[model samples]
Structures are given as structure tokens and as C-alpha cells.
Target chain A: ELQKQFKQQEEHAGSLQASMNTTQEEITQLRHKHTMVKAAIQEAKWKQANLTRRVLKLVSAQEIERKRGVPLDQTEEQ
Target chain B: LMRQAAHVNAWDQLLQQGHDQVQQLRLTLNNVKTDQSRLQAELDFIQGQQQELEQLIEPLEAAAASTTPAQHQG
Candidate 1:
């Protein structure tokens, strides 16, 4: 009976150890994924800023073109 | 039995530590998501402001165009 209990405890401890190892691996993977996602979000923000600048530049160019008395289609042709 | 008790105690401690690490990771993930959302909102706001500014400039641009040719021809 004592031997049986020892066997059971050993099996239980082994299972717990395996569970701990898997959980640790998963946590590490999740952390890596999180880092990647954070970087992507930052890159997207930079792209957004770049897009805003382009829009402003286009608007400024439009204003200049309007002042030049160029029709819209003619401006595009040029 | 004594050795088994010691093993069980150590295993339990390991489990507790693992749980704490998972909790910390979850918190960090939540923080990253929140930051992404806030930046997205700010981007939307900036786009809206840019549209408004562009709209305001349109009529002014037209008026300037109309006035300039008259000044040249006068």
C-alpha cells in the first residue's frame, strides 16, 4: 500500500511538472507574439502619420494650383 | 511519505510561480492593446481635423483665384 501511494505521487508530480513546462513555453510564445504585435502597431502609426503628411501636401499643392488659374483637368494633364 | 510531501510542496510552489507569470503577461498584453486603441482613435481624430482644414481652404482658394486674375487684367 505504501509503495502504491509512492507510485501515485510520483506520477502526479511528473504530470504537474509537464504541465508547468508546457505553460511556461506557452507564456514565452505569447510574450514574443505580443512584442511583434506592438511593433506592428507602432509601424502602422508611423504609416498613418506619413499618410497625413501626404494629404496636407496634396491640399497645399491644390491651393497653389487654384491660384495658378489652372482648370482641374488641365492641372492633371500637366 | 516524507519525501513525497516535500515533492508535492515544491511542485505547488512551481505552479504558483507559473500562475503569477501568466498573470503578469496578461496584464502586459492588455496594456499593449489599450495603447493601440488609443493611437487608432487619435489617428481618426487627426484625419477628421485634416478634412475640416481642407474644406475650409477650398472656398478661400477659389476666392483667391477669382481675385488674382482680375488684378492681373486690371
Candidate 2:
């Protein structure tokens, strides 16, 4: 009887190990995916910054001209 | 009979240790699950932010394209 119970316990341990392995696999995949998403976010933010810089260049130039006595309405290029 | 009793007691102790091992494994699993949940939420939030950032950039890109040739900023 004791031997049978020990055998059962061994089987239970095996089952639990399998489950733990599966969960570990899922965690690995999720971490991999999270890394990719973070990289993509970084790329997007960099693009946004570059675009903002380009647009600001034109606006700041016009501002400098207006401060040097050019009228705002006249600064509008047709 | 005495030897059988001793053997049985030994097996019982081993079985109890097995149960304890199982309990520890389960707790570790629960912790992994919690970690998974937190990571998933973080991923979802960052993805949402990425979408919002992309949307905000669209008009800026259009304006930039129309402004002039890409000027290299020093």
C-alpha cells in the first residue's frame, strides 16, 4: 500500500513538473514579445521627434523674421 | 512488525515532503502567473501609447514633407 502511494506521488510530481515547464515556456514567449513591442515604441518615438524637429525649423525661422520687423501676414508665402 | 512500522513511518515522512515540494512548486507557479499578468498589461499600455504617438505624428509628417527639402540639423 505504501509503495503504491509512493508511486502515485511520483506521478503527481511528474505532472506538476510538466505544468511548470509549460508555464515557463509561456513566460519566455511573453517576455520576447514584450521586448519587440518596446523596440517598436522606441522607433515610433524617434520618428515623432525627428518630424517635430523638421516642422519646428520652419516655424522658428518665421518667428525670427517677424521679430526682425517682418509683418506676420506678409510672412505668409503664397 | 516493528520493521514494517518503521518502514511505513519513513514512507509517510517522504510523502509529506513530497506534498511540501508540490506546495512550493504551486506557489512559484502563481508568482509566474502574476508576472505574466503584469508584463501583459505593460505591453498593452505601451502599444496603446505607440498608437497615439503614431497618430500625432501623421500631421507633423505631412507638414514636414510640404515644408522644404529635408534639412540636416547640425
Interface RMSDs of all predictions?
A: 4.8, 5.5
TM-score of chain B of 2: 0.84
Off by over 4 Å in 2: A1-78, B70-74
Model 2, CA-based lDDT: 0.66
* Residue B1 Cα positional deviation in candidate 2, in Å, after optimal superposition: 2.2
Native-structure RMSD, model 2: 6.9
TM agreement with the true structure for every prediction: 0.52, 0.52
lDDT of 2 by residue, B1-74 (tens): 99878977886786687677667656766765676686567667656766665666666567567544634431
Docking class of 1: incorrect
Question: Which pairs of residues clash in candidate 1, taking residues 3 or more apart in a chain or in different chains?
Answer: none
Model 2, A44-76: lDDT tens digits are 666656666665665676557547644554667
lDDT of 1 by residue, B52-71 (tens): 76775677577778878988
Give me the displacement of residue B62 in model 2, in angstroms. Answer: 1.0
